[model samples]
Target: MANDKHEEIDPRFKIANREALIGVGLALFNFIWWFAFAYGLGSKPVSEYHYILGMPAWFFYSCVIGSVIMIILVTVIVKFFFKEVPLDDEGEESP
Candidate 1:
């Protein structure tokens, strides 16, 4: 019956859904950034080096800028969206 399929979901699953969405988004972003850096910059000629600050532009963008962006994103997402879950129900009584 339709009612059987509509049984109440556990509360932990609600939190899990939100966290999974955020994680998937972050993973997609990482993949896109990785591809862009590898193909967009890595495709250039080896001798044609563009320096940002004594380092190749590709390195600067992929390593420094990309790292900073990822760090900021992770920090913001974890701080704002992630919830702390109990490791174990040590103190809770069993039914």
Candidate 2:
């Protein structure tokens, strides 16, 4: 009877929950940085780097900072909140 109940839950459920939290966190960062760059206060790129792409310095800085922040958040989430579960072949939770 206990086995029957345990068999109803998949090990992947915990993984999915962790992933959903990470997705939501990243989505928030996307919203924040996009708003900052597009509608909020950003560095005034009065100067441009004479690179091959001719991109503004502020844009480059934003990209670097954004990448660093995303990496940090992902690392924190994976390290702190991730849960591991062993599953059976039939998608059942282990005892």
TM-score of each: 0.71, 0.52
lDDT of 2 by residue, 1-95 (tens): 87665435645765776689879978898668755754332444445333224554445445655677777878887788776656445643335
* TM-score result, candidate 2: 0.52
Model 2, total clashes: 0
Worst lDDT run of 10 residues, candidate 1, spans 2-11
**Regions of model 2 farther than 4 Å from truth:** 1-15, 38-57, 89-95
Residue 31 shift from truth in candidate 1, angstroms = 1.9
Candidate 1 to native Cα RMSD, angstroms: 4.3
Model 1 agreement with the true structure over 1-95: per-residue lDDT tens digits: 65343334345556877899998999899778867876688789978878888888777887778888889999999998888877565655543
List where candidate 1 sits over 4 angstroms from the true fold.
1-8, 85-95
Write down the lDDT of every candidate, Cα atoms only. Answer: 0.77, 0.62
